[model samples]
Target chain A: MSRQASRLDAKKVNSEFLTLTYGALVTQMLRDFENAEDVNKQLERIGYNMGMRLIEDFLARTSAPRCLEMRETADRIQQAFRIYLNIQPTISNWSPASDEFSLVFDSNPLTEFVELPPDLTNLRYSAILSGCIRGALEMVQLEVQCWFVQDQLKGDNVTELRVKFVRRLEEVIPAGED
Target chain B: MSTYYFVIVGQNDNPIYEKEFSTVNKELRKEDHRHLTQFIAHAALDLVDEHKWKTANMQLKSIDRFNQWFVSAFITASQIRFIIVHDNKNDEGIKNFFNEMYDTYIKNSMNAFYRINTPIKSPMFEKKSEIFGRKYLLS
Candidate 1:
């Protein structure tokens, strides 16, 4: 199945349509919302919804076992993005407690065609990416807090997302009451 | 000929996919008997839970039995379960069936339209389930 999945993936996931569609969606959201904060929230909401299901597809394709620790999860997230979205982000800036780290990417496909207006500096164009990460982690019984700290679109050298380990959720086994 | 009933369970004991592969004639197969198959599958969830954490292995073979019927379970890493209720014991074949069903379940879940924990209503899923049931159970 992995062989078939990899073969199919090779023919799939061209970024042109995805990039343009995201661009259009953000533009429409920007127009619909009164402030940059609302627009960023909308983007993150969309990404969170997708992320809930994305983990299933990711697990199905990769059959990845559950990560033993937060550090392992960071590496798995990077690997997953590389395989699915074709982005290679480096993990750095670990907290002394090892509970937080940052994902640094120089070229984000979602931003390749995006240029933010100066007034919209507070708008996080890639908030959806962090939302997706949080949503996917929740499904695996891991609760995390993810947010954008820097954006190249805002003239930063690289895009950076700070991910903090909040707490691990315990799997709630059904009581079979139903 | 053994009759087999299978169910895929998601979180909160929600049954996502269910099927019966029966060699018995429809007219001869009583409605209560058919319902009994499902009830047995439901009753085994507790046993499945008890046995699942005992081993890291996915397949908990022959976890429950009722009268003559036996239940086999395969728990995914995400805690979704594939369960089988059968009158005859064929451990190897049941394992093969669970593995195939796991692949099919994953493919269905990967569909952008399909959610991880919901009833699998796709015709393709039904068709593949039938094919796998025939290949692994009746043979």
Candidate 2:
């Protein structure tokens, strides 16, 4: 192979390597702090910052960028939740009976092969997910409250995460006239 | 002898599996971690939440000097958290040990026998532990 081509290939490989390396590093940090709630808070803060950069990357990588509308962006986010994370998020009706929109987890990869210790039965372990989704959405400037409504470990067999959007992120939005 | 505590936290910061191990030379009961274990869990939670906004994946070695212990965290996709804690003296070995262990853990989690937020009592854990000790500590 030509030297230039070799260099280019190396660059491509190097970039790919960096991506996995970064992913593993983040997963490892979350793992280390998994035992400490305070550290987990720090981890989430780290995640929020990451979501900001990641959103930029997500936009740069795709060929067709802009969503047709606000609802289209929301749908794309839902699709990304599945394609990227392997977890399909269900959108539920939020009416008088329902408090907020929820992203239900039919199969949670994070919780697989996990059993809660007896003491934590009352306290939900999935708070990290809520915090994460909230942090990610917040990066896009969406104000949301995400929490675990049901945990499979608690015998519900279905994990439900609810996201209540408080308001659109107007501050980050572009300005024209209002 | 040193002691190590490891856990896998989901996107929600919930523990999927937790295991406590003291130096193989020392015999310690799992029940001993009742209090310290919770303390460790809380610390990890704090670290995860604190880094919720950072774009780069991090290795926060020795976040606390008082304990002479270091924490290594891995956060993926703004989802999934994996944490391992150990002493500073053997930090190098611990890193490689965890990298290998993670491969096993991921494979183990994929098995039908596995479920989230549960104790990691699979015989494979012991088998892997023994192998890890032999490969790293024995030499």
* lDDT top scorer: 1
Q: Give candidate 1's error at residue A104 in angstroms.
A: 0.4
User: For model 2, how does the per-residue alpha-carbon lDDT over A1-178 read when each residue is reduced to its tens digit?
Assistant: 2123224334443333433444344345546655435544665566556665556545444433554343454565576565445467777656453435666778765555454444445544445456556666666666766667788867786887776767667774467756
Task: List model 1 lDDT by residue over B108-135, tens digit each.
Answer: 6644335568888877678988998889
All-Cα superposition RMSD per candidate:
21.3, 16.8
lDDT of 2 by residue, B40-66 (tens): 655766766576555464444333322
Give lDDT tens digits, candidate 1, residues A31-124: 7787789988888888888889889888887888889888999998998789778899999999999999999998898876455655677888
Instruction: Give the lowest summed-lDDT range of ten residues in model 2 chain B.
Output: B57-66
Off-target runs (Cα >4 Å) in candidate 2 are A1-43, A62-73, A96-99, A122-124, A172-178, B1-139
Best by DockQ: 2
Cα lDDT for residue B64, candidate 2: 32
Q: How much is the lDDT of residue A33 in candidate 2?
A: 57
- Model 1 chain A is weakest, by summed lDDT over 10 consecutive residues, at A1-10
DockQ of each: 0.01, 0.03
